[model samples]
Target: MHKQLLLIGLLLLVLTVQGQNLWREGEMQVRVYVENQAQADFLKRSNMIGEPAGAFIRCYLTPDELLHIRQQGIRYEVEVDDLNKMSASMGSRGVPNGYYTVAQLHAIADSLEQNFPDICKVVHLGFATGMNELKAIKISDNVHLNENEAGILFDGGIHGDELGGPENLIRFARDLCYGYNNDAQITNLINNREIWIYYCVNPYGRKYMTRYNANGVDLNRDFGYMWNGEGNSSGPFSQPESKIYRNLMLNNQFVIHCSYHSGTEYISYPWSYRAQSTPDAQHHLMLAQMYSQSSGYTNLPYGQGYNGMYAINGSTKDFGYGALGSISWTIELSVSKQPPAAQIVPIYLKNKAAMLKMVEMAGYGIQGVVRDSITNLPIPALVFVNDFMCVTNNPVVGDFHKFLPGGSYTVKVVAAGHQTRVYENVVVQDNQATTLDVVLPRDTGRYAWRVISTHIAGNNPHDEGNTMGALGPPDNIRYSLGKNGYAIIDMCDTLKPGNGPEIKVFENDQTPENYMVMAGATPDGPWILMGHGTGNQEFELEPSGLQQARYLKIKDSGTGQSQIPDAGFDLDAISYVYRPATDTSGIIEGFTYIDWNVLIEKAPGTEIYYRDQVVYSDENAYFRFQADTGSFAMDAIWEMYGYANCPVHLSPQQHLYLNIIMEWMEPVETIAANNSITLYPNPGRDKVAIKSLTNNPLLSLLLCNAQGAVVHRIMNPQMNVDGEILLNVSTLKPGLYIVVGIDETGKSASGKLLIQ
Candidate 1:
């Protein structure tokens, strides 16, 4: 009897821990009648499923919730009394036989990548809460490269119970890959555009057949924009799934993005949290019309999400449009959440052409690259078309595409460390893309240039002002860091510890408010507190023990009332105080090379370290910085391995040039045996000579300090008849240095040199 009781207790505990599935034994699917947004909000508070539609909202409610609805005097009609039984009658506890399971879908993607190696490649997005790998298939001509091409994304299965979406996505991906060479339209699109299909976003939810993920949080409501603590979301993007999704969107500049759904047949666009239409309302409507017309359905209703369906915060559509400016939306495929197995193919067939049309239209707008005028290299910039704003370019390729109606409009380009450029009356044509390449000169001002791409704006309920106000110059217009609110801004250029004050904070108006400022090297920061201040003030970075910082976080000190307009700290702007280069400071300019030959392409993003300061080369592989005159060891790092050089002595007001060549680190034993180079006067100071024993001529020599920093370099040195190359090491500090020599055939030889 005791053993039976223990067994029963364990069974009950297991069921309790699992919480709610798609349908419980006594749960009922009901249509609730709501008079206004207030009633809709009330239903949401009751923890109901799905959003409101027109005067009625369909949802699954428990017996207790149904009784509460009656007590609240809300009218509701029961659609399905026993949801579990009804679902069982449709098929089984899991998906029907025709529907593909999560494992099967992943297998299909893997097989496609294997079969079509040229155009299809599987990209591992991230792991889900259940430890299942989230994957996306990229379809393009050059699948491996991040080319300057318009990108589009399609994703499905955010809600696990909505099964049709994943099926549609996987099928579409398969079709695109198979039709690449056979179909002309598909071939053209595959050649010109980069298409991404993220099938099965919520693998845990799909496997369990539940609306929520493994943690029981609704993935759809966990986005970071205008989040209001709905659907058990602990915070904005708190869940792993949402974090991975956010990274994908921010990393790629996708022109058009579509998220699939079921339980309703409609097309919904942005402004889901508010009633106001998006600035590109006409453009959204036009695309919706085109998509619907191309699809199998006729007269498919489409409109703004707020009224078209219902108001909701932290939705993927809103995040994609409001934050990143992608043409993003959700497509409701069927009236049934999980339709019968046989209807899956017909439903996919209905929307296949419309998906292709979206890919085609994604390139039909204004497309261009934003670059630096001086270096002629790509840069990330904000492109504003009249009133509609979008982050146009990415740092990798610096290409941007925006779908616009055919008309004349003002186009403004803004970038960090660059002057804002405006093009008046930039005309775009119908069904065709217009090129508007822009080159911005460097900005000499000291003001903070741009806001970090991603951040949580902990806005107060009453007065949550725009964070963009804190960017650019000091205008009277400011962003209010509401009671205990905060924001992160980017300086775009590194700010170092200078002679006097290195930073300035501008508070709007005469009202002085308390705030704390912190700085970090990256956006996700282990922040070092700068100081606390009231109102406008100048701060010195020297006190913080930080060598340099490019990102700043400012927070209100929670001194003001909780509910008030422009409460807490009102920040007008933040800037770096520039001091003229002194005679003690010396400038170093150089390029990072992949090979010793100057004709070869330069390597970008190589890290150059001198003393406590580190800087990365730009897209053109050029790096320039001014540092205080001193004898310091310099190191060039690539892929976390340091390549050493001789010590450098920077004289006052000296202008030095360097070319750092990155080489792979070989085994110590192998490096000593191969190439066969010898160094003489190992313990002597002033100079070192390198003589190669190999047949190849020694073309260049690099002398490094004990710390593996390249301190001295001799390129195209005059080799004697005995094949010996001399290096002037008089300026190098007395230490054990490593000498690396490059042969004419690009082979490398290494030897140790002791300078005393």
Candidate 2:
């Protein structure tokens, strides 16, 4: 009894010192024995680190936290009293001797890109808190292009202390890059699929041999979907690392996403925040089982994360599966973090076959493209398989792939600006794929066309509905804004307020739930409250004092139990009150191309801007918009390549067509030498002059703002005998501008100008 008391007092003293330090040093790994769900919940609330074994759960806790656990009378055993010291004792400072360091990993990626330029390229994905470059490598037949292929992402090192994941990922990447044409299966997979490898996610944590980033946030718990502020996350996707991950997932349509870790040997998938299985739980299980079977580990297990491990919120696997519709999961490589140097190669060899199999399986299942029935162009659409939801087609290729067990299922395709289509009894085989190309007719209704891609909030994976439910016309299907959750809806066209209610909110169910309707000129809004209502109702913008709005933010009034289904307002759709243009609207249609002279390759992703409205060119390089009849400057920008600007004058009911040729811009020195054009008084406060050394007569002069918008135009400008044209710039803003002179022969010369 005396010894026990002394031990307790010593533990208290250590904890007190640690509490004062505030975890500036590191954390301690502990095994807390639990007898019931309540104990497990307590550990989970304390940010459990690894899966629970028979009678205890393992977690990394600061001394302060351990003291609190002891105060609660929870029996625990200290596995590693100082995780940082243990990590240091494992090998070196950055990583184990055999394991690749963060800098070495980046150098390897660079080497791969340099050696196999045709099959590999490195993509710089933002930076970490410690200014380490977060990078990924793309391996495919056409690595530089976004081809219509099944995309799969394999990432590791999210927890820097998990040394084996990065080692496995880097080895896999090297094998894939080196075995391109030498290996048959590898060559075939490379030719047919796009593989992404993000080797190290937390360089700072890896460098310091810690579990969290420099900011002490666990990146795995920083994702946005169903986020609940666990693992020291300030908010959903609040960290720069999480934001980079979010952007990467949102920009690409990945069919399968695997995040690598090391703490135990298991394959865990989806619904990490709750015990309920995902709607695609069967599919997830089938894949996990296949992966386990393929791996060299004879007793590797696979199951749902919540039950197999413990409940967690804002996990990468959950975000990937719930928000992006990817077959996402975590592959815990070893039973120990930072395994011995001799064990690194053996561990990687064990999971290598399984990783390759995953890449191969990515191409299996339902594969097809969604397109416009009238235009015969590809459409970016969301695909639903019966009760399962949230799969999407690649915006660039309009192609989608979903892996499912051998069975017949219902498939539904929904796209913005198009009618929804459904197919019953779509048959898919176990090992084979089925193609079901769909062409949807256009929907001409005045409704919110698309849900703002990234602004969805208050999403619960356990709910019956998804974000897509708030799209299109009211068809009974709806997304529940779970207790204060909000979704920003994008009206493809602006809503002009004239008389009665200009916007209508549709609540599918009969429940009289209350919600607030707000309007914004942009997606990220300082929202102006239009009005409030219950159930299906109409709102007028007159009270909000807004003339026009392109975005609507609908927030559920926080009421009812959040854990229940449809806890708050159920939103079916939002519609706009359409008032026909009273002889004031005109259409602007155009095609964007790289170069009209040489092979005219259509630039599909070009941004076309008119006034404050911006639209992207479709798959066919075609874009059309209706605008109020007036003189407006228009521009088309192909990012990193070049931009084209023009002055427009619209008459009522006029349908003007243009062909925007975006030529690749050469270096300024090259352009000046090639075009023989010079500008005098370049940084002038009042005026500047442009002269052509070749004596090329100028037909017109255009002054473009920094954003490539044409602000001023001069037709038939007079020039002196020296072939120089003088331009006045006193009225322009004090910024850099591009002065473009078009010769009579249509040859153009550009020079930079600055105004004070």
* Candidate of highest lDDT: 2
Q: Report the lDDT tens digits of candidate 2 across residue range 197-251.
A: 9888888778767778867788887776667677888766778888788768766
Q: What is the TM-score of each candidate against the true structure?
A: 0.71, 0.71
Local distance difference test scores for all models: 0.75, 0.76
Report the Cα lDDT for candidate 1: 0.75
The residue-level lDDT of candidate 1 at 104 comes to: 95
Q: Give the TM-score comparing model 2 with the true structure, all chains together.
A: 0.71
Clash totals for all candidate models: 10, 0
lDDT tens readout by residue for model 1, 381-441 = 7677776635547664568888887888888777755788889988888888898887786
In model 1, what lDDT does residue 294 have?
94
Error of 1 at 210 (Å): 0.9
Stretches of candidate 2 off by over 4 Å are 1-26, 45-55, 84-92, 445-468, 486-504, 517-533, 537-554, 575-627, 630-756
